[model samples]
Target: MVDNNWLAPVWTLFQQQPLAQGIGLAAMLVGISAFRQRDDGRFRLRLCLYQGAIAFHFLLMGASTAALSAGLSCVRTVASGHTRSPWVMAFFLLLVWGLGIPGINSPVQWLPIIGTTIGTWGLFRAKGIVLRLSMLAGGLCWTSHNILIGSIGGSLIELSFLFVNCHTMYRMWRQPLPNPS
Candidate 1:
């Protein structure tokens, strides 16, 4: 018989935390919807909601670092909608690093911190396709973290986000760019 126990841990996680998995599924749906929005403001609004939901999902899954990062992401997404101020961006970056550094037990823990950092910079400095590209990079980090942590829903969310984001980017690319005034 071939040793095929690789899925056991993920199966155990799903069985042990059905509620968390449910929330993760919901978060995944919201995140997919967020990326589908062509309007930047609407996209940010939906992303904020998705972040908050994912934060709760992480909390229930006992991923404290991921939870904190997602919570901060919720706030940062909302704040990013209001201003692109470098000072504000700098503050959030510092906050993520300052709070996240103490909790680092392994290199894997760095994933969410780095993901959030990329996302924060993208929100503050980029818009349209560039922002989505940055988010794509961040999603890769989160996807790896999710798989390592045995979070089936988190893994699904990031993978789905990557596909949806790419489609949205393609849609944006097909449209003619606004003439620079």
Candidate 2:
């Protein structure tokens, strides 16, 4: 018989931390909506909301590294909206490594750091399709981390993010390029 015991941990998390899971689910909705926005400003605003919510969700679930990453992401996403300065990007990148390095108990902890680094680069250096593509990569990293950490809502959100981001990219790609002045 196939082992069906893997779900026990997921169920236990649900039973133990229903509130955190609910927050994650809500964050997922916000993130999905964020990607659907055609305007970059709206996308960044909504994504910042998602990052904040997910940070709290990770904190409640005892994923400190992931929480830290998400927290920084919240700030970074907002900053990206205001400026795409390389100096700002460098600062956030340093912050991620500085804050995230000491928490390394296992290799799994690296996922959030790597994801956040890529996201920081994307947010500061790129726009539109390139930005979303970087987010897709970051989502993959988060998905693996969530699954390893037994975060039901976290896993679901990353998985959904991948699909939604791809669809949004396709939509953006179909639009004609804007005329440069």
TM-score against truth, every candidate: 0.92, 0.92
Query: Looking at model 2, how many pairs of residues clash?
Result: 0
- C-alpha lDDT score of every prediction, in listed order: 0.93, 0.91
Find the 10 residues in a row with the least total lDDT in model 2.
Answer: 171-180
Residues 115-167, candidate 1: write the lDDT tens digits: 99999999999999999999999999999999898888999999999999999
Estimate candidate 1's alpha-carbon lDDT, on a 0 to 1 scale. 0.93
TM-score of 1: 0.92
What is residue 42's positional error in candidate 1, in angstroms?
Answer: 0.6
Per-structure clash totals for the candidates: 0, 0
For model 2, how does the per-residue alpha-carbon lDDT over 1-181 read when each residue is reduced to its tens digit?
8998988877888999999998988888998898888778898999999999999999999999999999999999999899989999999999999999898899999999999999999999988899999999988999999999988889999999998899999988998457569
True-vs-predicted CA distance for residue 83, candidate 2, Å:
1.1
